[model samples]
Target: MIRKCRFAAMLAFSAMMSTAALVQAQAADLLSTLNSTHVLTIGTSNDAPLAYIDPQTKAAVGALPDLLRAALPLMGVKADVRAVAMPFSSLIPALQAGRIDMIGDGIYATAKRRQVIDFTSNTFYNPEALDVAKGNPDNLHQLSDLCGHSAGTYEGTTYVDQLKQASAACPAGKPIDIHLYPTIQNVFADLTAGRLNAGVVDSSLSAYALKQNPALSFELVADYKPADKAGSACAFGVTKGNDAFLAGFSKAYATMLADGTAAKIFTKWGLTPTSFFLSL
Candidate 1:
């Protein structure tokens, strides 16, 4: 019986190794296929600064796409990196369903998301903020202040999960009413219409929107630090098991950092840089 047990253990180990090898092979084949095709479809949101449609040219152009155009060539990928602007909530689904090759816009690699999709190394970091009315009627500043109020944000974003967590932690079981919208524009519209007291979003995005519409009466109610230790590190989202693509993409990204390309991209968008990681 002991010998049989040992044989079973060995068989299990062998099976595991075989599965890993198969995954690696698939990843390599994917890279080769993409290289031969000479094009990579990138899914992004109309979230300004990070990525959005340029009003003048009607082309998708922003920090994320600019960074990709600068670094992809270093990886020997001389392809037309096309950007497809879609609703914020739809980017992930499109990536997972093979409708797009990658997610170019800002996506936080939270533990829950990591289970479904893979992320490249940390590209940049920014904190969450509360976008309130111009005169600060609600007097909101931090996460706790949102406990009993209505909060608006885009659906399927890290902000939504953070707000939910904040609501769950409210004292005396008084939860905040979290309202999710399909796009950031909807959140802004509701906020302007007095439908929402505040909207939780990335601080940088809030700044961009406020700048774009100077007449809009919206003000950021101070930056809020989330309880989650990860904070908000943005990275490129990719299909799970695509290890070959990740490896090449990560290496090219490092090259960008070494040569000062990364800093320029962030500065152009008015966003600060984050710590580097070969993998997230």
Candidate 2:
């Protein structure tokens, strides 16, 4: 009887050990599959109210981060939002090389980028504008006004393409002299220094710059209509085949929209929130 009891106890111990191992294995597999702790890297510029690096904290704090924070929880993922500083022109290449997972700030979805990256549903739409030195000196009001005048823009941006298009259509000898800068700051600096008569950029960014330099006296030209089809919108860029991550992001985004979290963030940034299709 003693031998049998001892054997039964040993068998029970073995079963418990096997059960515990299985449970641990299952837990490990779940952890591996969920990607809960992976860093959700984002790229952005110093564009204020959108994705600027806070001077005090040296961290990204703006509309995009606020929105992402609200959406991340629904995915059962905790994101370590690291801002990878890069020129706006380099953003796409950085994304393709996996230097960053997504762009945190404003990005207009263009046909060229659609081939390599997938964009999340549009978050906010804003118009593009031209910034010129304060006063009516240039009398530059529209793209046509730029004929025979110098214009500066950030390289590799939609604004550059728009300027180029306008230039191409101009009558001979009436083409706008286009200057490409590596960064928006440089473009604006050149404008302030009178190196360029006007700088074309996103409206929100131009507003922020005006706020930063109240005495700068830069005015938005009145004649330049915002791009007709160029309603700039912010979207997340994911790898083309990243279905798991994409699905998770879409789910979280939907929850945020349904709960009005997305609207609140946009409102905080003084942006008009627009309805978006939630199909992942």
Candidate 3:
């Protein structure tokens, strides 16, 4: 009995030591390590104009990726930013799972999301808009206009909550028919096909798509009133509680904002810099 008890105690001690080592490994500060290792993994989606993988070159292109690339040298981070493309909804989970070092997409820095992940300072302000078939057939002008109509947006976006708010205010028996897709491109696809009455997405994203494909027979509601009083400030996301990385990256990002790097990136991507981006 005495020998068995001693063996059991040794096993328990070994297990505790292993658990402590795992916790320490998980909580490691990734900033200095990344700078030394020269590799950083990022998660992005098919969110174009902000971030996307170019099909032809298989390179990550767009305003967000460009900004991230520019900030690297400033922070002395020389890591090869490997871009991992996934559905929009998977970015956060992958980050939490330690599969990606950062998120290279235009994730809005809202209070709710901040609870789960950290974000760099606001990089740009983009307003929400309603995209509809050409000529605004249904005359949907604002959030409330979505009531009793088939409206769509991508999963894991702020627009989902916005649509729900509009639906709640709708008259009894008249709720906005909300549909969720994997990506904004899917939403636009159904909207142009006349399957969905409207699509609520970032105004800048919609405008960028139209500029890229003029034949896409959809139009933005002119003089549209948005559900929120103003737009949202979007930024790259990182794992929560990553103080070392967030501190270094945020300072470098601020330099990018101050030194005109951010504006130049937007222009390079055919995006106008007259918006609040310059002010950020």
Instruction: Locate the minimum summed-lDDT window of 10 residues in model 3.
Output: 271-280
Candidate 2: worst 10 consecutive residues by lDDT? 271-280
lDDT for each residue of candidate 3 in 33-92, tens digit (9 for 90 to 100)? 687788877899867888877888878777877787888787778877667899888999
Error of 2 at 164 (Å): 1.0
lDDT of 2: 0.74
Q: What overall lDDT, based on C-alpha atoms, would model 3 receive against the true structure?
A: 0.83
Total backbone collisions for each predicted model: 0, 4, 0
Please tell me which model should have the higher TM-score, number 1 or number 2: 1
Pick by TM-score: which candidate is best? 3
For lDDT, candidate 2 versus 3, the one ahead is: 3
User: What Cα-based lDDT does every candidate model obtain?
Assistant: 0.79, 0.74, 0.83
What TM-score would each prediction reach against the true structure?
Answer: 0.82, 0.79, 0.91
Which has the greatest lDDT?
A: 3
Q: Give the Cα error of residue 275 in candidate 3, in Å.
A: 2.7
